[model samples]
Target: MNTTDNTPSNIVRNFMTALDSNELDTAANFLADDFVFSGWTPKPLNKQAFLTLLENIKEGIPGLSFNIHNVLEQNTSITGTIQVQGYQTDSFIIPALGTPPIPQTASSVSLPMEEVTYRLHDDLITAMDVEHTTGGGISGLLKQLGIELPLAQ
Candidate 1:
């Protein structure tokens, strides 16, 4: 890739690396103060809210880690699949989905590679759109919900 393409991709990759390692402070550096984190739902969040949400996530997931499998960067946007792993003490709520009021309980469920799209401002990520693999279909949704009937085996 040319310099034009490499810059943003590297920035995003670095951001992901920082994020995956639970480096919120480092990740914040790559985010604009006006950063808007779209995709996470139940209620959309702006910058400060998103930061607060991340803090809550850090509390919930504890040692959460991420592995970005495949990333594709084009003009002002990057799309990719990412695998995330974390330990859940009590069931975590899925705010993005307007599902049952009750949060699903699971010790842990291996989630699929969630698709993520990032919109950049200059080199910093300004906004994002993330779609969990669960968005695929009923089966996908069930998988994320930790209802792997037979289990993946």
Candidate 2:
């Protein structure tokens, strides 16, 4: 690991680490103001909304964890697999996805390592797109919990 303050991989690792550690304030520093995050919801979430989504995930999953691996950087883009595992033991709130919070479903999930791509610009994350497949990201996590969201018709 370069460990340099500005390295894309370093920045991304730090950001995810912060998120998994529930250090949202620290995580926010690594995101550009115009940051966009996808795959967690039907629509893309902006930086603030993305942070809120993480918060909701933490609150919903209680002890959810993130393990980032297989990071490969090419130009301004970084691709990696992030393994997210946890139990849905608490009510989850994601306004962009649904109105009221989802009650605890007493379900557990260990992702097969979702492939994530992060785009960096000027040392801040400009965009993050989680793998658009079953068993990846929040969408997959919800499915694992037996909660099916209404598809875009």
Candidate 3:
């Protein structure tokens, strides 16, 4: 799907493409002004903050890419599974963990499949939520970088 297309599925495809390509402007154009993003971080993110987080991820992870395996649309919502792969090229803190930025080791990590759900209104994405299907969530991703966290009580 093209970025100009506004259909729910198309918008999701374009948005993910733009994000994987680091095209912040194109990605932002697909979102509503009051868009809310949940997942990746502990707190929800608004449109501007979401864009900034995308930029930070792009900077921290060199060669970042998202491979979409499936997309399903129902009514105004679209859900899909994606595989995210990247190499850590610089020191960066885990937003979800809120720890100090860890030095880069140039380690390559391929996060397990994640499910993303996007809700659209008037052709613009208004809400997005992501969940890990397996691999222990954020901690699993961190494990790939040789960082381990204590198990939850």
Question: Who wins the lDDT comparison?
Answer: 2
lDDT per residue (tens digit) for residues 17-82 in model 3: 888888889989999999998765556789988887667656678567878759999999899987
Q: Give the Cα RMSD of candidate 2.
A: 2.4
Q: How should the candidates be ordered by lDDT, best one leading?
A: 2, 3, 1
How would you encode candidate 2's per-residue C-alpha lDDT over 1-153 as one tens digit per residue? 444767898888989889888899999999999999987567888999988888888888867887888999898999998888988878876766774567788888887777899999999999999877666766677778776665441
- The sequence of per-residue lDDT tens digits that candidate 1 reaches over residues 17-121 is 887777788988888777887553434567667666555545556565657767887888988776666665544433334233324354443456778888898
Worst 10 residues of 2 by lDDT: 144-153
TM-score of every model? 0.69, 0.88, 0.82
> Candidate 1 at residue 55, lDDT?
56
Runs of candidate 2 exceeding 4 Å displacement: 1-3, 151-153
Q: List the candidate numbers ranked by TM-score, top first.
A: 2, 3, 1
What TM-score, to 2 decimals, does candidate 3 have? 0.82
Which wins on lDDT, candidate 2 or candidate 3?
Answer: 2
- Candidate 1: segments with Cα more than 4 A from true spot: 1-6, 89-106, 135-153
